[model samples]
Target: MTTRVRDDTWVWALAGLALGLFGLGFVVRWQCTRGACALGRHEWLFDLDAVGSLPRLFTTSLFLAATVVAVRVAARSAGRRRLWWAAIAVVGVGLVFAKLVSAHSVVEGLDGRGLTLLVGTVATVVGLPVLARLGRAWGVPGARAVVLSLAVYAVAALGLDQVTGLAAGLDPSPLPDAAATFVEELGEALAALGVLAVVVRRLPHPAER
Candidate 1:
């Protein structure tokens, strides 16, 4: 028999981690009025600011709770079709979070930068499941491709911002703060992908059971 674990467990854990880290960012924002100086002074607080409150924190929390239930229900569905739904939910929420944290000054309206972000968001929504499916079939290289794609997106977004003079980035060397935000979002996405990879690696395939 295949060893099947609860999908809700994984979903809830991911949601909780996301919420905690997002909440911590909000805390850090509050504490660091003078840019990152306060944060540097209270470096220990980094533990707390790991994930500051996610955008529309209350709504996101409710959605996450619902996600837990959805994953549980999907796990028991006829063909596990709910997996696609769960994947979409994860990607959609991730895109929303990215939109929220990204520097908007570069792409405030429905212009060039905004269009680029929209296209990237759509690509992410489509790419995640494809990446997952590929990972299961091709292993590490497939996962690496997904990560590299994300990094590329980050770089492209920063480049667009620079060309259009949208926002500042955090890169000390050359990129502005807005570009830095894109890199940061990319980092978070990579981290999320890592967690998903671990979960997929541990869970037994449906046929194995």
Candidate 2:
């Protein structure tokens, strides 16, 4: 990772995107909530009609563009194999659906939770095999590091709510909900970058091994 950061331009791009999301999403969140209560994004957007769609549309566009670039790179080297093509369709649809969800917005009630869980489960099922292959394309050390970074990202993005809910049920302490929210947003950016990194890391393909 260290050497790749210096040698590869994509690494720099990924790093920049990660930092940009952290600065934009995380910093605003901290300012609004002061690292205290969770500010539900859909609720906030529900009231503030003017400023909500701008950021989500903008960020989603950027992420989709990055995904296209990664897919292009992979296709160039590996060709459009089954996993490659299927992964693209799955992730592309997922991102589009995510964007639609953001634009339409959903109240985080029981219905919303069920919807979100369903979407998340489907995405996880489709994405895991592709992501696993990408991680292992790197050798053991690089693969391990990439997978770990992605794990941090996954936990922060996907499982944080469940973990926090359990914690709250067990002990109603002041959960840094604000902080967790920012981490979740930041993790999305980082996770996307991690996928890009795996693609353009200049490592040998699995077949080469």
Candidate 3:
């Protein structure tokens, strides 16, 4: 008999992680300003200031979550084993505690074109092998879509702000700080959800337990 786990296990796990992280960011923002949250002044306290780096935090966490998911799904489909997930559990638990401390850390956005290029290029190179392995099994069913979605996500989540900054720096058409934050955070959330969707789609499903 093939060992099987419910698809809902990972589905719920990833969903919860994303929502919980997003909420934690909000809580930190709220507490930082004691809930003042005025339009002009509160923006910095939220995520634009040097009070914690949501972009780095979420992007790293979510990317790690994806790695966990991919490794888990691959293991499940390839073998009847589940022990590999324990590694992810360790990091996830540690991160839960780290969030509180991160509240006081400097706010860092996905700035720096050089950093962006390096991260994107490295992720693509590392991911190519994994995707190829999946292709051998899933046979391009949804792999291409996942790649496209994640590419769009990376650009939207990590690159938009840099572009806005460059434009503003060059021509002095600066966007309101609040508006910029909103756009950046929105991109982060959307990209996160998109990646989760792709991961969920790739997980192997059994018709019945």
Candidate 4:
């Protein structure tokens, strides 16, 4: 019971932290958009679209941490369980690189919508079933929650973002560009943090192992 409580505490704490960080970015963005705050030289720190912004860094760090935890878990696992964690770790690493390099721009540069659709379709058709089988074999706690979080992240960051861009090109978008960017970036960061929390919860303490 105590261990369960502790695990729940960690999950809630990480969720709060993710929201708090997003709130801070939103406030800064609102102030800057209103010409109320003098961003001066540190504007990048508050700009959600910037590559090395605070939000981006936090998100990248979360992915890296998740990867580390997955690697550790894999090291102690065997057979299909090890493969499951190893696959998750690889995905985490890809996410970290994607965040750091702003991979969306590259995707957009190359037939954006088409590429996204193709990749999303392939992932849904191929990746989901494979991962589902591995997940059932491993029986990792909180796997469903983590997958749901990733789904939300993909919708906000990939789907909505492209739609927003297309709308902006066609006419004056109902959703303000800044607001859309803020939501996309915040969704991604929160999702990454969620994945990290679940992975951490499943990783046993050194003493336990």
Candidate 5:
């Protein structure tokens, strides 16, 4: 396919919408627990709200946005094929992962070995296919490189979380810490990759290959 380069208004719009929805989610979560549930008032608006934190919001938004971008990029780089199913898988699994991991602090009266196992299983089943679909969209040639870049991003996010934790003295325990770290890192990575993919495609390819 001949690569095309131009500013896709939809891409920017999608990014803005994703970020806005994320901020909205935070407000909703804050209001829900504080007002409706009567969980006692806490500073969430500016205090990074324990509801999910910046990392979670950033990562999740990136993930969703990346999925949409991936479908489009796949169509351009590969071919114009319906990648909605892949989008669904990626988005669905991500939601499940967030829900499962968030249960500990976000939900009450729900903590057991079996339950964690079940949630993990569901997330795995869903996430695997989602990743696989993303790979397909990326195509065999570039899939490994994309995934590797994403992995590196995830690790960097973890490092960032650690730094943030040290400065803020947030929860140090492994489970919650790791979960939040993963969410943020993965999300940022996906969004970044989506941008990079578009930029790279737009650039003129070398004549040799």
Candidate 6:
């Protein structure tokens, strides 16, 4: 009972820390945008849209941590289960790189809309069944939460971003551009943290198999 309580506490604490960092990043962004600081001097650090910004670094850290945990989980498993964990680790590494490099902007420059559609279709057609199998094989604490967080991350990083771009191109968007960026970035960090929290919770002790 005590162990379970401690595990829950750790998850909540990590979640809170992730939210706190996100809020601080947003505040800095808001201040910089409103002329409180020299925009050119601080934009690289505070701008949510900037590559390698604080928020970007934070998101990357979360993904990297999740990837490490996935690798650890893979090391302890075998057969199809090991393959699933290995795939997740690979995706997590890709996410870390994407966050650091602002890969989405590069994609947008090269027929991003069509590419996103193609990728989304393939993911849905292939990913769902694989996920179903993984869920059965995963059998770890917080597996559902990890899966759900990944879904949320995909929606925010992909779907919401495309909508934001489309709205900006077509008309006045209901969401301010900065606000949309904030939500998207925050959602991504939160989702990554969510996955990390679950994996950390489920990670076996060093003494365990």
Top candidate, metric lDDT: 4
lDDT of 3 by residue, 37-80 (tens): 45455454336323345544555466566666766564655332
TM-scores of the candidates are 0.32, 0.53, 0.50, 0.79, 0.39, 0.78
How high a TM-score does candidate 2 get? 0.53
Residue range 1-209, candidate 2, lDDT tens digits: 22323456766775675566455554454445444425555434412112344334444554465456545544544333434433543555565566546522353354644465566656566656556676466323244443444354444545654544455456543335444544555455556555545534534445542
Per-residue lDDT for 109-134 in model 1, tens only? 54756576666666656775575665
lDDT of 5 by residue, 1-209 (tens): 66555666655665575556444544445445344523334333322224455435554455455555554444544332235334433543454355325543333236533454455456545654566566676454444445444445434433454454454356654434434533443454344545444423433344412
**What value of lDDT does candidate 3 attain over all alpha carbons?**
0.51
lDDT agreement with native, every candidate? 0.45, 0.48, 0.51, 0.72, 0.46, 0.70
The worst-scoring run of ten residues by lDDT in candidate 5 lies at: 40-49
Residue 15, candidate 3: Cα error in Å is 11
Candidate 5's C-alpha runs over 4 A off are 8-42, 52-58, 71-92, 95-141, 168-209
Ranking by TM-score: 4, 6, 2, 3, 5, 1
* Residue clash pairs of candidate 6: none
Tens-digit lDDT track of model 6 for 113-145: 668656754764587456756767666444566
Candidate 4 Cα deviation (angstroms), residue 158: 2.4
So what's the TM-score on candidate 5? Answer: 0.39
Error of 3 at 52 (Å): 4.6
After TM-score superposition, the amount by which residue 146's alpha carbon in candidate 1 deviates from its true location, in angstroms, is 7.6
Going through the candidates in order, what is the number of backbone clashes in each? 23, 0, 1, 0, 1, 0
Judge candidate 5 at residue 191 and give its lDDT: 49
